[model samples]
Target: MSRLSLFAPDNFPLIQPGQPLLPAIVDALTQGGQPLADNDILVLAQKIVSKSENRFIDLGDIVATDEARDYAARCLKEPRFIQAVLNESAAVVRCVPNVFIVQHKLGFTLANAGIDQSNIDPSCINEEHRELALLLPQDPDASAAALRRQIRDTLGVNVGVVISDSFGRPWRLGTTGVCIGCAGVEPIRDQRGQKDLYGRTLQVTMPAIGDEMAAAACLLMGEASEGRPIAVLRGLEVIEADLPATALLRAGNEDLFR
Candidate 1:
């Protein structure tokens, strides 16, 4: 019988831009009496990765273009915010009053280009930067890889890293955790041609294990006011792979919605 375990270590202090995250994470795990183990999967909130990369954008610094202003007026959103969304989006999927959805630069279809202002510290919340928004990491897969390498270099442990964010889907009522970046993990488990209980060969079956891990971790990292931003998943007999979260995205040619 196999078993799986998931737990968050003691919360660390606020992280700043350009901070060395791997060392801090290791220190926190040591202080919390939960050290990193081999094959442990480290699931992290996307917000922290973005913050560490200094992806914050001040709304006051943006000057809305004519098209952005027009779109903002139609959507009833701040012009600068809309501009930021446009900057981060590969293409606008839908735009309407009080709602805007887009294909993020990272190829994920999300609302407002994933530019979030909630749960931000007050230090950047003064009048000058009242509408501060954090952008997703520019290259999340790279971020995950770098973090993985750092962990290996610092602790000599092999572990997986996943960067996740909350996303709302079509026909879904609320948000759920979704993987945007991953490293040292197999993002998908293809089970094609595998025999089922009835001895029927499966033609198409692919389980997104990375997204599942992200969702499971999300349960501990609540959407609002939850200081927990990291979780370690253990006992997953996942074969080490070089697949990124992008491997899990349905290609545009295969997407029916587009």
Candidate 2:
């Protein structure tokens, strides 16, 4: 690609449960004078997609089991919150005071199963609920595909979609955006047996393109207080790849970190 561009609308609205996302995105883009175009990829924060999908849980609604209570005691968190995490997790990786990491049912090993409490609007939350938490979308890959389809149907433009979430690596200090779901994008680009600039044969050079794109767009969508939840990445040539984000996950046998 000759050049890359990233654009985020300055006035992205605070998303609410069950809200439709496409119209808001289009309105924001049109207002910002950066209308959507063919081949443009949209990188979205997972929170917005979850909110739109109404993937919310009331801490008051949870009834902690004995196992969940034990985990809560160790993590120094609420039993109900721990119970919610336990319900969402397929396996518990580790638990410590104020930190509980688990492998989500979606096969991602992340902290608290990607359930978060930050950036939720209290005004939008029902008064009956004591504390509300947002969970990741049920099927993020399907959500991405649905979004891509919506754009194509409504605007008559083919585009790519990426649902990104913040993740912390065990060896890394801070968290960065990662591709949890994607459509019309290549999750991994295999460069094995390809020749380098000096005509040297290359091996073991597969790049996680989806994660790279998500991370690059996240530089515009800040983690906190940045209202900009969506970003447009232009000039990427990976469109129509139609690969799922699961391709980014390493197979169990190839996972040397664990």
Candidate 3:
């Protein structure tokens, strides 16, 4: 029986702008004496990724078009960022007062195109810096690949990496972490055709283990407290080796909700 533990380092500092998260994480793991091992999964918060990549946007510097302002007025969002997100979005779903669901160019149908306001310096709120607002990486898979390479090079160990973000589920009250990118791990574990104790064949038993691991990491890497933006998940099944997150994405036509 492989057990899961959510490791949180005490009194970690806020990730500064322009800081690389991978090195910090490697240091943390070393300090914790929880060295990365084969089959281990490292779950990281997207905010850290965004911060490391300098993804932020200044609300004041953006000039909102009439259409953007009108939509922002209806959605109750900041016109500048909302407009930018809208411009980047491929499709706009719901545009009610103060809320919107947009499909980004990355094929992710998320709120505000994943634009975030939390965990940013207030002083930069007025600058027109595209670096502040992260454009979804051109290829999340590629990002995961790069991180995996870096981690391997830094630690001299083979391990899995997962980049995650918190997202609200439709009809659900709270949010949970979802894997936006991953490397060296099978994101989904399909159990269909497997038999149970009673010899009953398991069907529809695919588990989003990557998402589950991400959510577990988020519990310790809280949005506010804990300051720990990275977590190490040890003792996973060895089957998770070299697989990426795209293997977990449900086809839009097969999904019932989208």
Compare the candidates by lDDT and give the number of the best one: 2
Which has the higher TM-score value, candidate number 1 or candidate number 3?
A: 1
TM-score of candidate 2 relative to the true fold:
0.97
Q: Which RMSD values do the candidates have, in order?
A: 1.6, 1.2, 2.7
lDDT string for model 2 (1-258, tens) is 289999999769988889999999999999999999998999999999999999999888889999999999999999999999999999999999999999898988899999999988755877777489999999999999999999999999988999999999998799988999999888889899999999999979999999998999899999989899999999987647867998888766788988
Candidate 2: where is the Cα deviation over 4 Å? none
Ranking by lDDT: 2, 1, 3
Per-candidate TM-scores read 0.95, 0.97, 0.87
- Residue 76: error of model 3 in Å? 1.5
Candidate 1 per-residue C-alpha lDDT over 78-164 given as tens digits, one digit per residue, 9 for 90 to 100: 998999999999898889999899999889999999999887774744555666789999999999999999889878999999999
Full ranking by TM-score? 2, 1, 3
- Top candidate by TM-score: 2
Question: lDDT tens digits, residues 56-133, model 3?
Answer: 555555688998888888998778877788777888878998778887777767788888766666554344443345
The clash count for each model shown is 0, 0, 8
